[model samples]
Target: MNILIVFNHPYEGSFCNSLLNSVQNGLKMASHSIDLIHLDKEEFNPVMSAQDLKAFRDRKPVDSQVISYQQRLEKADHLIFIFPIWWELMPALMKGFIDRVIFPGLAYDYANKSNTRMKPLLKRIKGVTVITTMNTPGFIYRWFFGNAIQRALIRGTFWKLGYKNRKWISYNRVKMVNQSKREEWLVKLEKQFSKF
Candidate 1:
C-alpha cells in the first residue's frame, strides 16, 4: 500500500512530530511505500487567488506543485493527516492547504446541472486516518466541536471522495499527561500502524 502522511505541526519537538515519525516508521516497516509531506516545510503557497480559481474552473492550468499533490492523493491507497487541534479546529495553514490544493476540478467535479452532486476523483484511496492532539479532554472536543475536523475530513471530504474505512485517533489533554500515558499512546499508535 502507498501511504501519504501529511504533517501540519510547525514545531519540531511536538507530540504530533513524534506521532508522525512513529506512523512513518511503522508503515515503512510494514512494507508500505511512504510519502511524508511536512506542510510547514513545503515551498508551496497556500493561497487560493481568484485567478487560480478561474484557471481551475476553466480546466486550463494550476501550480504544478498543487497538481502534483493532487496526483499523489489520486495514487495513494491511504492518506494520513497529522496535526494539533487548535480552537477545536484545524490550523489556518492546514485549512488553507486544503482550500488551495484540493480544488474543484482536482478533488471533485460538479457535472450535474443542479450542482447537487459531485464526482469524486480520489476513488483509488481506500483508507484515511486523522491523528490529532489537543490540550482539552477528548470528551470536551466531542461535546463542543463534535469532532469537527474529523467529521469534515473523514465524512465531508474523504468519504465523499470514495475513501472507505475511515478512522481517527486523537491524543487529548497532552498538557496534563504523564510520561507513562504518553508512551502508552505511542505504543497504541505503533500497533495501529502495524495493522496497516
Candidate 2:
C-alpha cells in the first residue's frame, strides 16, 4: 500500500515524533511505500487567505502547495495523520491542510442537480488512520467532547468522501506517562499497523 503520513507536531523530540517513527517503522516492516508530510518542518501556512477563498468559490486551484498535497492524497491507498490534540481539536496546521487540500471537486461533489447529497471522489483510498496524543483522559475526551477528532476526520471528512475503514488510536495523558509506558505504546502501535 502507498501510505501517506501527515505529521503536525512542532517539537522534534516530542512523543508524537516517536509515535511517527514507530508508525513509519511498522509500515516499512510491511513493505508499504511511505510519503511523509511534516507540516511544521514544511512551514505550511495554516491561514486561509482571501485569494484562497476566492479560488475555492470559483472552483479553481488554491495554490501549488495544496495542489501538491492533493496529488499525494490521490496517489495514496492509505492515509495516516499524527498530531497532538490541543484544546480538544487538531492543530491549526493540520486543520488548514484539510481545508485547503480536501477541497470541493477533489474530495467530493454534488450527487446531482438536486444536490441532495455528496459523492465521494477519492474512492481509491482504502483506509484512514489517525494517531493522536492528549493530556486529558480518554473517557472524558470521548464522553464529554464526543471524540471530536474522530467526528471531524472520520465522519465529516473521510466518510463524506466515501471512506469507511477509519481507525483512531489516541494516547491519553501523554504528559503523565513514563518512558517505559511510551515505549510499550510504540510497540503496540507497531503491532496494530502491521495488520494494516
Candidate 3:
C-alpha cells in the first residue's frame, strides 16, 4: 500500500512530530511505500490568492506546487493526517492544503450543470486516518465540542467525497501527559499503522 502522510506542526521536537515518526516507522516495518508532506518545512502557502481562486473557478490549473500535491493524492491508497488541534479545528496549513489542492475537477465534480450534487473524483483513495493531539480533555472535546475535526474532515469532506473507511485517533491532554504515557501512545500508534 502507498501511504501519504500530511503532517502539520511547526516544532520538530513536539509530540505531533513524534507521532509522525512512529507512523512512518510502523508503515516501513509493514513494507508499505511512504510519502510525506511537511507543511512547515515545505513553506506551504496557506492563503488562497485571487489568482488561485480565479483559476479554480475557471477550471484551469492553479500552480505547479498544488498540481504536484494533487498528483500525490491521486497515487496514494491511504492518507494519514498528523496535526495538533487548535480551537477544535485543523491548523491553517492543513486546511489550506485541502482548500487549494482538493479543488473542483480533482476531488469532486458537480453532478451536472444544475450542480445539485457532487460526484467524487478520487477513486484511488481507499482509506483515511486522522491522528490529532489536543490539550483539551477527551471528554470535553468528544461530548462538548462533538469532535469537530472528525466531523469536518471525515463526515464533511471525505464522506462527501465517497470514501467510507475513515478512522480518527486523538491524543488529548497532551501537555499533561507524562513521558511514559507519551511513549505508550507512540507504541499504540505504531501497532495501528502496522495494521493499516
Against the reference, the lDDT scores of all candidates come to 0.80, 0.89, 0.90
TM-score of each: 0.91, 0.95, 0.95
Q: CA shift at 22, candidate 3, in angstroms?
A: 0.6
Ranking of all predicted structures according to lDDT, beginning with the best and ending with the worst: 3, 2, 1
Please give me the total number of clashing residue pairs in predicted model 3: 0
Candidate 3 residue 128 Cα shift, in angstroms, is 0.8
Model 1 Cα lDDT, one tens digit per residue, 78-154: 88899998998888777776777767776777758897777767766777788899999887788877878777877
lDDT of 3 by residue, 1-196 (tens): 9898999999999999999999998999899999999999999998999999998898676688898998998999999999999999999999998888888888789887997677778788888899999999999998999979878998888877777799889999999989999999999989877876
Which pairs of residues have clashing backbones in candidate 2? none
Ranking by TM-score: 3, 2, 1
Estimate candidate 1's alpha-carbon lDDT, on a 0 to 1 scale. Answer: 0.80
- Model 2 TM: 0.95
Question: Clashes in model 1: which pairs?
Answer: none
Better by TM-score, candidate 3 or 1: 3
TM-score of candidate 3 relative to the true fold: 0.95
Candidate 3 accuracy as lDDT:
0.90
